[model samples]
Target: MHRPLPTFRVNGAAIRTIRMSAGLSTSETAERAGISRRYLNHLENGYRDRMRPGRYAALRTALGLNPDDQRLLARLPHEEPD
Candidate 1:
């Protein structure tokens, strides 16, 4: 059987804050991150508590997250350590 992707529980508020500060709309951010806007909204609104690591990294990169911002994300709990 195919294994399920691991997920990381992230801070939705922090992600939303960074995205807004970067002046990116959900649609734009999602596009940049190669994900759906609805999924991004779900993440930002905490409707979804966790995301796959690749998606998380893509979101971070799309938001242009800095070291400090990365630190903020480092507090996340993951299914597996990186």
Candidate 2:
């Protein structure tokens, strides 16, 4: 059985939540995330299944999330410490 990549989400609840909350255009986020606009689009639409750490770092920083929030976002389905 193949496991889904931690970054690839069927529903994209996390990605969409961050994007919406930041009020950033897809193009803007893509640039900040250090990915192509198309890649970011795919990630946002749940069309792609993986995001690299570099992209993750950029996105987290651009969104102004703290280290903990970034970890939570990076972990996805995994729960963080209370």
Candidate 3:
């Protein structure tokens, strides 16, 4: 049997925590991350589960995540579709 590819999930709580700790408003964060405010809201609210790699990289860079934060973000659990 062929193994399924691992799909990574976005940890909204982590993103929200980082945004709050950085004292950034949703608009500010979204602008810095090069994404729309609506999308950011979805991510922060846990409505969205996955993100493109480029977007993820932009988000990480925008948030100025440290090594630990990056690791935590990477470790977020993902759900595999049936």
Runs in model 2 deviating more than 4 A are: 1-11, 70-82
In what order do the candidates fall by lDDT, top score first? 1, 3, 2
User: Compared with the true structure, what per-residue lDDT tens digits does model 2 show for residues 2-80?
Assistant: 9864552223457767777779887887777677888767766768756656666676776677756643243445554
Native-vs-model 3 lDDT? 0.77
> Which portions of model 1 miss their true places by more than 4 Å?
1-4, 66-82
All candidates' lDDT scores?
Answer: 0.80, 0.64, 0.77
Instruction: For residues 1-81, write the lDDT of model 3, one tens digit per residue.
Output: 998655456778888888889899889989998999999899888788678777887888888885345532535235323
Query: For model 2, what is the alpha-carbon lDDT of residue 44?
Result: 66
lDDT of 1 by residue, 7-76 (tens): 8777788888888888999999999999999998888788986888788888888988743455325263
Q: Using TM-score as the measure, what is the rank order of every candidate, best first?
A: 1, 3, 2
- Clash count (model 3, backbone only): 0
